[model samples]
Target: MTSPYPPSTSISPSDMAAGAKKPTDLPQAQIDAIIRTKRKAREPKACYPCHARKVKCDRNLPCDGCVKRDHADLCSYERPSKKRAQAFESPAGASTSSAAEPTEYYSYDDIPSRVKPENTHPGPDHLGVGGRVSIARDEWDNVRSRLKEMETTISSLRMGLERAEESPAVGPDSGSVQSAEGASRSKGNSPEREGIHAANTFGKGTVHLGSRSVMAYILNNKSGSDQLQALLEGGILPKLGLDNESATYPFVDLWSSDMSSFDISAVCSALPADGQCRQFFYYYRDISGAIYPVIEDITKFENDLELLLAKRLEAGGVYREDGDQAQTPFGTSIAYLGLLYAVLASGCQSSDLGSKERELTSQVYVCCSYQCLRMTNFLSQPTIEAIQTLLVIGNVLSYNMNPGISYVLLGMTLRMGLALGLHVESSRFSVEERYRRRHTWWSMAWQDSHFSLSYDRPSTTAVSQPNIAYREGSQPGDFSYFETLCKVISLALEVVRIRMLSPNAHITFSSFQEYQERIRQIMIEAKPYLRDPQYCSSSTEHLERVVLKLHSSYFCSELCRPSLKPSAGRADANTVAMRKDCVSNLVTTVDAYIELHNISYHAARSWIALQRAISSAFLLAVVEEAKSDSHVLTALRRLEGIIAQRASSERAYDNGDVATSNITSSDQGMASYDPVTGATNPRGLSHPLSMLPLLRDLAPNLKLNGPNL
Candidate 1:
């Protein structure tokens, strides 16, 4: 190709071929190269809109091209990124630097061209992959467009921030609103000041925030300042650092504080007639008393009671059928009366009396007991009478009333016993006193731990300090059974303490095995007592032992249940085996409880046994797999039979068909009623153990039978 313009030396091809004058000292090769080069095209310099539209733009504030189209304001000569970068950079100088020259600030329309350094480029799409700088044109354009939009948005934000910074600072006269600096300087800002500050800063839109921007603004504002202030002003908030729940409702004394003496005569008048009282008393003595040896000297109490009853019945030859008395014929001491009332109430519960009659009679006894308790200074020191009374009342409430309430009373009993230093073994006390204290402590501990387990909470009983073990040859009759039961209970309590009480307790296979081993040893120690040569011959004794053994197995089941629960991570083979063991134990427990009802079908029932039976049934029912097992189904049916029988009796009573009660001749007391022994006829027996509140809650589920039923 030939050059359009002549080079430094003009040499036409024809002239060069002719070798006519050498063109001004230029080499022939250079002349030819220059002539062959073509001129490059000029780069475009129009705005994107005009360029895209292919229109000629006379670039102006309102370009001629845009003005012609009636969209002059849309004529943006300023590139988006440059305009945004100027806005962002402008704010810092305006807000932060007093000495910044006004001219140094660039307006949006006057954004200076930024010089990018040589070899600088945006990051590659894939660095070093085939040494590529490859990017599709559309993608590169999209990225550049997004970058410009982000810059513009950021600049707008900076401008808003600059305006906010220029807003008036809160002054001392700005109502109750304190400056941020002042609020911080103050030792403690009362809730009032904090709330006022939040209102002034946030409520008034001091940050010049839009809806989208206000979220970050509000979150960064002082937290809960307004609510705290309101609570404080209302005096509903506790003092700083106090537990909110405990402070909200202060403790109120359960016992009344009148301290005035109660009329023993009035309380006695509330008691049933001599015959009825004797019936309740003798029933309690033989049945409940035998189980919990709360009575200090049973022989002397019987002798005194017999004499009092005989005199009361004679009553100067009045021969009154009602035997209504204005005063008690027996003792007037508050402790004795309290003990008597508690005994009567518990006995009535265990009797064959109709539900309405039992409830009413028991209530009267409970009131009388309360009256005597209020009159006496039982809490001053531990007395044999106080221990006996507390135990009886606690047992009554446990079996027939709310277990939660019973649990609370047990806590009180434990606290009272501790107050008397029952936990600390003492030689200063008599042998009888020491023994009584030991039993009392164990009773409270046993009750607390058992209920605690059911509640899935920690027991109040602390095994700190010196505790007494049952002395050999000291236990009368099957009292040793209770001792053994306590041992099992203690072990169960320890398991509960480890697994439930400890906040972060982890149950490992080794821990599970260790507990299983310990419980097994305890069970072995208890086995002989269950079939003790001393009481094995007596059916009543044997039954009591059976009940004890059943509870022992239940404790073992409880100890194993935690290990069986599916853990958070991978399953351990050992855990699976332990779970099988747990299920087997649970099945065994259900069988044992069900067998009790079968053996003593129409006998006086123990509330503890009922509770254990119900719990075991529930345990089986809950395990989805267990529902299909024949053993579980059989246990559930037996439990259903027992519950249905009780419900029928209750329904009969409700229908005023009291004569149809299941409390027949077969519904004998723990011991046979013998006139020679001063033992009264037994009524429908109630248990001494509190029924778990869970039973009532689980009623719907318990009533829900599987297909087998």
Candidate 2:
């Protein structure tokens, strides 16, 4: 598929949906049959729980055997509990209370009258299992194919000062070979070099060049998102009780500012009108090294861009004298790493941020979660993808499949969310209204048809000032939220993490299956809550405006809207020089997302904040290993400063009476980091810095909030 492959010749799987039968308006008798099928559990497979309890032999079986035999009272097959369960069968026809709890299901009256079907959803744990045949593992080759489509998107990057066609803002000339002493001097000894050169020799110790070639962009075109949307909007999903309201809208923004500001004119100043700048667009990379036609210059530009990214991260937006503007989702998820190329391809570069601390770590997860959440909403609350994304990045997943990272990261986010009191203690929506709002967040983000409630905290407890990693260059857990918001983070992380075992791997596979079983139990128990069908209608106010995020389609279809498709318009020989800045722009654009995610989401959670800090440390190791990814290191240092300052700021605010409940609940919500203004004013931006000077000045101002911004 990565071969600039031809289109497929198969019918859309949805056009012939496997079970798109049984008219929308079914007879009550048909409903009754399905309902009866659900109410009366199937013979053997359904009897395991009861058999484990060592109950009587009447079984709900032989078609009403339990009901016929007075053992109906013991026929507890309805609802399941999520928190705990596991008991063994005994030889005698007696049972013990070793089982966690009896099954729980929605009572007939508990369900909404609007639902055409009765209370027959088998509660949560055993959702949609009956009256439906399981698809074979091979049957899901379509999903694997979709994943293959995703796999074509991997790439690696490097950083440093290098030779340029013209004098770049940073780095000495590469082809102008340096003598040993000249190279040995660090940043202070020479204005032309830094403490960086000790590592950036490009293939000696750390800076290993790409061994071979493998870079390709294989676009995906086979998603059934439109049909899924149709199903969702048509109430088909709600009808199936798959309509769960999501508790969060990850990014605060709707539309990312368009690319109206970019200018490719300057490169024309030195160009011969050849298409080299344009030709670099189609290149791909594999294991073997494939040099970009524009790499010599573009790579240096990447270093320059990191300086810009630092400013943008501090400034909270981009500003270009040439009018090139780039934007991203505020709480960018993991997939936003794709922006690494998008920006690079646009001829803009970004910072290295060491390895893990930047947007690639946080934003990558954000993007992955965003996509996975949407994918889950499309498929039935499948928690596996988000888990896998987190697991793959840092498989610190331990025996229970819970990563210490997950614990720290998720716990941090939850704590911050609580302490920030983001939507807490207000004249907030009632349960029903909150459910509706959650539905919009879910629809926009995940297309989920269930899971209507936010991760709930128990009754209002007097919150204490939590602990944080407030010091400069602190490791994880440096925020005040880490101690208080434990339950929320622990549970959410537990849910997202347990499903991420690599079944194909030797260590995690068997346990992975067990994890799957555990998740099956948890989700089934949580289904009734997630599949809250009270939210059957799509008439909520946010519904019309909420655009559901879906997987991008490479092939053209009216159903999918086009994402960023920039034309390096009218490139001439000089566009190469100008395009050199593209790597920098890409870096800034990306780090902007990273900074935003850490600040906006993870920063709120103490544990997650600390987890991110640890990731940042590891990433710093990666950067140190690479030796010369200076921009990345600079970005990381800048980020560390930003994080410390924010934490300190929040710690101060939290210490103040304003963080207290007695101050009047009306003003409870407090920003740990000052809100970003999305400042467009160039005055708030670097007015006009010389390329060389701007490159040299990497000192970031964490407290300098833009006035106009």
Candidate 3:
């Protein structure tokens, strides 16, 4: 080929073709290389609207500035013409595969849209995941809204109660409403008027919030500024790492004239512009004064409180059966229902958690126990319908995936079940007088007439009948009232948690150890207490009952069957005579309660075995008291046989050997949520050793089985 160049630079084709393979007349390779280079160099730079709107435009994806914003997703690049694209197509002019290989095409934003001066994003949830900086946003939005509504109801009722107290002209309805509100508020916030509003998230004392102690939240229709300040210092915008949850509502601090001005706008202002980065704090509570440590060395503080309530009952103490008075914080009927809901919530969520997690168990001991102490007013009222409603709320919350609320509900449920039993065992109240309290929370919430499995209502189901553990009524300090006593343990455990003294809890003689360790060492420390011949071979029993409160959608399932119960005579009516576990003296009062109500002999045996396990604990406590006063020791000495007999009962090891409940037609006490027990540790059940059985029974799938505790 002749060179195209002019004579000065031209060379003959023969002379230039030495290294060129075929001396091609055309430069097809040179053209392909140029096209490849151009394609590799392409860059997207459309417009700002396209970048922000997440759509690609002919102009480009994200220009240089979009890249600077760290939003790589906004980048759209320069493109080649369609003709250029055709250059790479297969010789056949089509892709052979039915489906194209998964190609990684970068997506882009829209072209310039209508411009606006307003902020690009709407409220909190306006942006896509790739373009936002949201942090631990309170997924409690729905909860917050519900809390707001509840607060409104509480405020109105509280006003009525206070006004009623101040004026005889106040009607019962107003007084009752006030009472209800006050109790409920106390549960979430605190009853301690002297404390600040939420200060710390992990539960601690005040942080000297920037303002001089001023009253803010309690002010009527307060400003958002002051509210923000308080919230900045307090509100617990309850965030538990879930989506769509509302923040924990800021509690009204009526007691503090020092902290003033609780404004929501201010609270919002306090929040970071990026709602996720920060959380607003709410409330200032003196945990020592009102909080219950549901999570502690303790497994079920509710059990202790229940025992205490039962003791009171045996002492002939009269409790309000159908009023707000039944709603006391530590062991109120209403709060008790909350405990039942908590139980169901945790039980269900735990099963649903897929791994049988113990998170709910700890939270139960800490968060749920607060009900017994904070809601004293409600417990005092004992409003049956009110108690039932709380359970329904628990059930509703149980469906939530939020573990925090689930934990709180579980604690509430345990307490509620016990309350049901205490009320049933209350001699001072007639069954009809408390019938309203007996209805299940589901029924109360919906007021549904058709709540049943088969034709029978939950309370009347055979398999759902009460266990026999609730049948005994013995003595003051007798462990029989364990259900009520659980409330007391709840209080004690809270005290330990707040004080950080659980580590110093006394387990045995001169032996101080962490409360949890002490609990773990039950068998070890128990050796001394069990050495007494009294606990061995004695038939004395410590019983407790379980009423399968829930019936499956079908009543015939194994979970709902009630087996034949032991036929024990009211044995000795005088067993109702309360023996003083304190110093031998005149009657402080007879404290007698049933041990087992309608459970099987084996279940009763398990209860009895548990008592033996804790025999040393009771003896240890009594012996310690004896050191201070020999007279007290004398009382302990006289009760040896009875106590020993109870211990023997605890030796029953029914684990897998015990039969599943059999639904006998004669079964009674159905749909009951209470459990009765004999060996009520005035200090709470021997460190929750019983929880082991419970954990086991409830494991894998727990909805069908009742736990050992």
Query: Judged by TM-score, which candidate is best?
Result: 1
Candidate 2 lDDT at 264 equals 21
Best by lDDT: 1
Question: Scored by CA lDDT, what does every candidate get?
Answer: 0.52, 0.25, 0.27
Q: At residue 601, what lDDT does model 1 achieve? A: 36
Q: In model 1, which regions exceed 4 Å deviation? A: 1-261, 290-293, 296-300, 307-332, 465-469, 472-479, 499-501, 526-529, 532-535, 564-571, 599-605, 658-709
Tens-place lDDT digits, model 2, residues 230-316? 322222211111111121222222222332222222211211112322222211110000111112123533444454445445544
Q: How does each model score on TM-score?
A: 0.55, 0.17, 0.18
In terms of lDDT, model 1 sits at: 0.52
lDDT of 3 by residue, 1-709 (tens): 9998766334345434533333233244333332332333223445433544433434423342344334546343422223345567666666554124222222232221111123545332322112222222243345457768986886688667545543433222110111211211222121111123334344443222101011111121122223333323333222211111222321222233334332222221221121111110000000110111122212243464355346445534533333553333223343443443333333322121111122333233223323332333444454443344344333323223232343344345435545565323345656443332333321221211111111112222111222222113532233322222232222223323322222112122112123323323322322222223334222121221111111101111111111100111224332111111111111010011111212222122121122222221122222222234544333323223223322233232112211221222122222211112322111111112322322232122212222221
Off by over 4 Å in 2: 1-594, 597-610, 613-617, 623-625, 647-709
Point out the higher-scoring one by TM-score: 1 or 2: 1
Candidate 1 lDDT over 53-79, as tens digits, reads 556655545654555454566677445
RMSD of 2: 32.7
